[model samples]
Target: MQLRFLLCLCIVGALAQSDYDEDDGAEGKKDPKEIQDPRGHRPVSRGRETYSAGPAAPPPISGGSRYRGRPTAAPVGKLVLEKEEQPDSGGCNHMSEKMGVLCPTGCDLKKTVQKQERNVRPTVDQLKRSVDELTQSTNSVYGYVLDMTTEVAQRQRVSEGNGLLVGQYTDSLETQHAYIKDAVDITFPQNIKILQAVLDKIREKIQRLEKAISAQRAKCQVPCKVSCPIPVVSGKECEEIIRKGGEESQMYLIRPDPLGMPYKVFCDQTSKNGGWVLIQNRMDGSVDFGRRWDDYRRGFGNIAFDVGKGHCQTPGEYWLGNDRTSQLTKMGPSELLVEMEDWSGSKVYAQYEQFTVQGEATNYILAVGRYSGTAGNTFLNGATELFGENRTMTIHNGMMFSTYDRDNDKWIPGDPSKQCSKEDGGGWWYNRCHSCNPNGRYYWGGSYTKYMAKHGTDDGIVWMNWKGSWYSLKSISMKIRPFFKQK
Candidate 1:
């Protein structure tokens, strides 16, 4: 029994030793290197001494031989103690504990972080200052841009205003230029014509003056027994005299007469110190007494009595004879007279005087008379008689004369177609003879006498009336006198 006990004791002791080796390290102490953290910090080391609270109680020995080969477990409390004693053996949960225990590398990290923070502070300040400068510069640029914009707008407005003004001025100038051009176009030619007319008048005067000078020189050099006398009047003087006559007579003295005497001649009796003398009458004694207007205009046929014929009568001249059927005979130049014998054997006559008018010698009758008739018988009896007798005088000289008609108080002229009536008896020729005897013992004569004998008379009167009607003239005595200028 003693030997068996000894073997068992030895086995038990070996088991306990094995268990201690497994539970604790082989040295039964923690290594500082193994306790280092992931942050590279080493744990503070405890002294290399054995750790014991007191003597531990022995574990219960197993009686069976099965326990002989097996190791024993340590106490639970001792395992927990071993875990707590290790340095940095825990995970990230132990980082707080290492905060107070810095390693060499940890100090370098702390210093680097502090240096970077210090550098960042200055950089932040510089960045803030740079930002402020940039903002201010931007504001300034914006203000400058705004000012430029405003100035540009203002300049644009001014330009626009100037453009409008320029446009208006251009339009005004154009209008004025057009007006001036039109005025010049309308007046320029007219002004030229007026100037040319004035120049022509001046040239005519100069020519007249030159001719007068030549005539004066010739008159002084020549020695003749007789010299031509200067003219008593000129064309201008004749016009003056006519104007005076118009003023005195209150009449328009122009040809062809407005009363329809187209055969009238305008005699400028300037050289005879006379005014206008009209020659207008029909001398032809044909049965058809109406004169042609064209023949009268050309002074042809019976209207050709001019100054060259003096007082001689033409082939178809007028005649008043006792039988009233004798051929007409011309009078002598010196004794150019128109005479007729009344039923009482009294001689009635008309005489003329000769004068020069506008370089043409003409004869103008001044008086008509009944030399052996009763006193005042040569004077006109009625307006119609005066008109007829004045017409006879006009035929002798182919001249128109003014005869005062007492009935109408108007001058009568020699126009065959002139309007006449008892109410306004103021024309040489008449279609009706008023206040006279048509079929009395005294004869009534005129252009209508022959027509009256052929185609009977109406109301005891004869006339070459319009529309082929015929009428006879009434008997009335009349006398005529030439019209002279009032000097």
Candidate 2:
């Protein structure tokens, strides 16, 4: 607003300056014979007339007089002689000299000079004042823009903080609501139930409002000029993006859930007939995997660049977040693919025909079936006999995700002292623990040394049946694609 006002003032000033120059040009073309009386008389009329005097004597005037003697034969304006006492001999000697004029009659030169000085001085002064005002307005506008930028930055920071707070609050409510409800019901019965009902209504309203806000944010998040997919109605996943003319394996925006804001995802357009969303990738150790529950829920690392850190030269190390993964997979029939590379450059993969991740209410439970690939089916039945009878319990299928902060693994209820994610230094689905711990620590070499193990566990990225628990893979990626049946 301030910028617009300053621009208007500048335009007005320029127009005023232009108009003043035009007035000066018009003044230069004024008739010499038509002069206004400084003391409020009518303009003198111009006519052809001749003045005859002895020897056509030069008009007596002092200091660069404007008047010139008119020849008897030449035509000139008739000079109006005012009624005034005749001047002394020293003054201009002409019929018009008695009125302080001379020859083909210029105005009293003194009065013309006084009128010009009077008109021009104030105009110049006004222009100077206008220039100063414009400069001041420009300074003010610049200051306002700077302040507005700072305010917007601060608001963005605050908004991010609020998002974090909302995530935490929602997680707590989802995780512990059963316990909270039981406690409240026992304490006050009817009164507490009424209050709880009111709270539920308020929560529902908040959720609706959040969905509305998310929709608005999705619309504005991507620029119109960009080839970003339309939110809510289209481009729900990488497959949808491919169908809509997307040809490259690059970062694309998608909104899997209609009530959620759009987010960036790496689309693998050339992999396995295309239309795969890269969910997790770890080639280098640039990004730490030992994050808390909220971190896993919201994701971390950079998804814009597909290449990871350091020498591996593959997709970057990042987690796509549990919430978005669940939203994506639950949309329809989805397939999961896990790819890994050993130190010797040999690559292996595990593909699941049926795959889905439940929401946070189920602790983001993993569901996979019909596995077929080079890599062993460690997800359901490929744990070594290291645990003897407990080998079956090591399967990661149907296990809830666990993190260092929120332990939802099977070991947490049986033996609280043995937390899979805490001992492994990463978050993942654990059943007694995982057979394939892809989110585990990244080791420098294929084999993890005994000294590198934490709590007597090799937490390195391990697909046990393919490379054993002690061997840390060089690179690993987990991606998913929805199955689109033939029309």
lDDT of residue 399 for candidate 2 = 89
Regions more than 4 Å wrong, model 1: 1-114, 125-129, 201-487
Give model 1's TM-score versus the native structure: 0.22
- Measured with C-alpha atoms, the lDDT of residue 468 in candidate 2 is 85
For each candidate, what TM-score against the reference? 0.22, 0.50
Candidate 1 pairs with clashing backbones: 279-399, 280-399, 280-400, 461-472, 462-471, 462-472, 462-473, 463-471, 463-472
Residue range with the least summed lDDT across 10 consecutive positions in model 1: 322-331
lDDT of 2: 0.76
Per-residue C-alpha lDDT of model 1 across residues 1-487, encoded as one tens digit per residue: 3564575456545554555455346545555654535433332332232233446533223221222332345445744222223444333322233432232244444554455556455655666687789889999999999999999999999999999999999999999999889879977778989999999999999999999999999998967642222122222222343554422211122322244432212233332233433232222222222223222222332312223433211222211111100000111111112233332344333333322111112111122222233222222233223456543331212222112221111224344333232222222222233232211111234333333432233223222111011222322222111234338
Q: lDDT of candidate 1 vs native?
A: 0.34
| Error of model 1, residue 478, in angstroms | 76
